[model samples]
Target: MNEVFDYVVIGAGSAGCVLAGRLSEDGQHQVCVLEAGGTDATPLVQCPAGLAAMSKATHLNWAMQTVPQAGLNGRCGYQPRGKVLGGSSSVNAMIYLRGQPQDYDGWAAQGNPGWAWADVKPWFLKAEHNERGADAWHGQGGPLNVADLQQPNSLSQDFVEAGVQAGFARNTDFNGGSQEGVGLYQVTQKNGERWSAAKAYLTPHWGRRNLQVRTGAQVLRIVLTTTKAGLRATGVEYVRGGVRHTVHARREVLLSAGALLSPQILMLSGIGPAAHLREVGVQPVHDLPGVGHNLHDHLDALLVADAPQLTQSFGWSATGLMHMVQGAWEWHSKRTGRLTTNFAEAGAFLKSSPEVSRPDLQLHFVVAKLIDHGRQTVWGHGFSCHVCVLRPQSRGTVRLRSADPLTLPLIDPNFLAVEDDLQRTVRGVQMARRILAQAALARHGAQELPHSACAQTPGEIAQWVRQTADTIYHPVGTCRMGHGAMDVVDSQLRVHRVLGLRVVDASIFPSIPSGNTNAPTIMVAEKAACMVLSHAEKTSVAAD
Candidate 1:
């Protein structure tokens, strides 16, 4: 190794995958990527039906839990993160959504100058390569493939029609201009397998002369060096295979450790609340108070229903083992049928009212009636519809429990704090009930199993929600971007009062996007890469 490079990216997750691949494409600058997990070597990672095992397997998942929130009825929420090459993208629901245009405009209004909706749309288009081909809204020739659903179930169509019954317009594409609609969701899948960020962007670029990939490397902290000019990010100290090493960065160090761990890494590197660092016996470098604030996530409740189709999950059959095996064979050969389905095949995004402006809720329709997040297969055939309030009003925080790197951090989602947001979610459930009562769904005679006989008042439903809602497992916004005093990064995703460093991940969102955040997180990385290259060019010119 040269002991230094133009850029060094930490964590080869979603953002790091793209950043390292794109930045080193020029071949002039050396780019090294540090990944905490091993390669995407397991078959479970590629199988659409394999997530159930992966979710339970601790091998590649951080699988951390929050430290009891008062807002969530004293419950600690589950947080499953990918500890692998693609990061959570390897294990996520694979639903592709860019979120509402207004989401970006709100960031621009929050004093993040270049983050307006207009500014980010190009990057979104630039990174997508849809299977249906190119259009004004989607790109055809790009690294990631946003393709049609491999498996389409009847319940998905019923869900769409049910949305129309619930007063939502039928939208074919959520990525299109308007997000208010009901339809089947697009996914990041190719030929019945998951096309994760590592699979799409990083895999193609592997072994490039300018790129270096290091797996099983856990970063301890960034090694900062001081010069007469200012503080420079010299390198990162990390552990791989229980051995310690250091890799230098000649230009800048970019952290793509994600929403949760990015701030934890920063705090370990001495760039967080000074008091907390001192309390943990670590000397403070900078007292940036916003390193781990603004934590937000999507809280969803999975409702059970007796649907007609009982063949939803592989965990369902005993004698049908051969059937599941045959399906897998078909998928491996041609990429079709149940084997191709990503389970939660169809979904929709919409508001409870016409004047809401942005979609306030979303639906995730499961083909098979699931029981307890697929932990136990339902004895009888059934289906599920997960309801989540998108862009929740309440904000939370993430903080360190101590200074130890292995120690889990504190995550409080602070859900249902706003009475109005609770009411909105109650209305969301009511809409879901209406959909179940529709002709298309009632034809199947679906019954709500987590049966609540309580009155339909906002108070009643909200109370039930507090008692029942579980995480859809989408967490974000820990490192907020704005011009305010509490903001950690500016619009360019550059940390305030810090040079030669940047954070490109979900943590920098000023507000939570309207829906699933993985695609938007990838888009953020795309825009960040452009900004980093722009800054590098400017820095080079100034130095010359």
Candidate 2:
């Protein structure tokens, strides 16, 4: 391993890939990226339909389960994070959403500068290569490919019609115009295959001599030194193939380890709450109490119904299995067919209460009866609609279980801790039922599952949601960006009270955005690249 580099980025996830690619573009900086997992070269990672199989592949997934929630009848929720080159983007549903503009404005209001909607839109465009071509809202010739799904199931189109019939506006583009309607989602796909962050950014730049990407290199801790200037992060100590190695960063160290692991890494480096550090047998280096605070995630509840036709739904029938076999051949040959479906294809963003300003409830219409994050099986063909609170009032935490760098961190989302969060979720469930009951969907002879359908009263619905709701795969804000006492990083994404270090990932979100987090996380990294480069330029000039 190299002893030193201009920049060392931890975790080659969505953010790290962008940083590695962009920072090394000038050919003047040596950038090294470390990933805990291996390459994303399998068909399960390249195909859009492979999400079902990939989600179950334990080797590629962190498979971290949350501590028993006080909500959900004390049932533990499953937390699946990708441990590969592209990180969660490799295994995600591949939906490309940048969230509402007001989400960024909200961040600016919360003490973060240059993160308002107007300020970050260009960053979004900078990293995008939309298939629809560039306009005022999108870009062309960018690394990330955003395109329409090659083949969306008829059931998904029916979902959009059903949503429109249920009194919602029809939106053809969620990224353009307002985000208050029903539509088919545009995915991060190229032609017919999945286009992950690694594929978009890092893959194209693999030949860059200044860039070094090492897989299966798990970072043990950030190597910090207490110099007279401050506690500076010099490099990171990582274990690769059972042997430990250290690589120093001559410029800065970027922590892109994600929400679940970034805080743990910081705490391990003695940069978190002093009491918690001492409890875990680590001496405190920097008493930054907010390292693991402000953790939150989107909790969603599914309302499912039966769809008897094998062609429209996925189930255990012989005919369904036959269709799957045919679909596989079709996709392999022409990259077209039912295999191109991203499952949660059509959806809506609606307000839970008319009095509320923006859409607070987000829905995902699935062509299958998804239960327990698709871990459990249902007997027959059916469809399901996932309803989640867009702006949850509830908050949670990620704390160290021990000082051991390899141990799993304790994740407590504290979902439904706020009564209003449960109330909003109940309203969301009612909305889902209304849309499913619309004639556009009812024509398929789909019947709502008896258990959830029977809950007519608000109390009954709340109780049902509590027993059933779980994560829709968005967890963020553990290492928030702001100027507050609890904020870990500032608007520039630099860790507070520390020099020569920064965190660029979902972990630094000041607050969770109003939609899917992948695109926004990528945007954050794009902007952070400029910040890091500007810092380096100034340093160079000062030295000259």
For all predicted structures, in order, the TM-scores are 0.95, 0.98
User: Model 1: which residue pairs collide?
Assistant: 369-382, 369-383
Stretches of candidate 1 exceeding 4 Å from the true structure: 312-315, 319-322, 451-457
Candidate topping lDDT = 2
Task: Give the Cα error of residue 44 in candidate 1, in Å.
Answer: 1.3
Please write out the lDDT profile of model 2 over residues 1-544, one tens digit for every residue. Answer: 5699999999888999999999999899999999999999987888788887765788788989899999889999888999999999998999999999999999999999899999999999999999999998888888999999788888888889988999999998889978899999999998788999999889889999999999999999999998899889999999999999999999999999899999999999999999999998988999999988888899999898887774567776888888889988998999888888888888899999899898988999888888877777677898989999998878889988998999999999999999999999999888888888888888898878888888889999999888888999999999999888889999999999889999999999888999999999999999999999999999999999
**Considering every candidate listed, which one attains the maximal TM-score?**
2
- The residue pairs in collision within model 2 are none
- In the range 221-275, model 1's lDDT, one tens digit per residue, is 9887777867667888888888888999888899999989999888898888888
Alpha-carbon error at 418 in model 1, in Å?
2.2
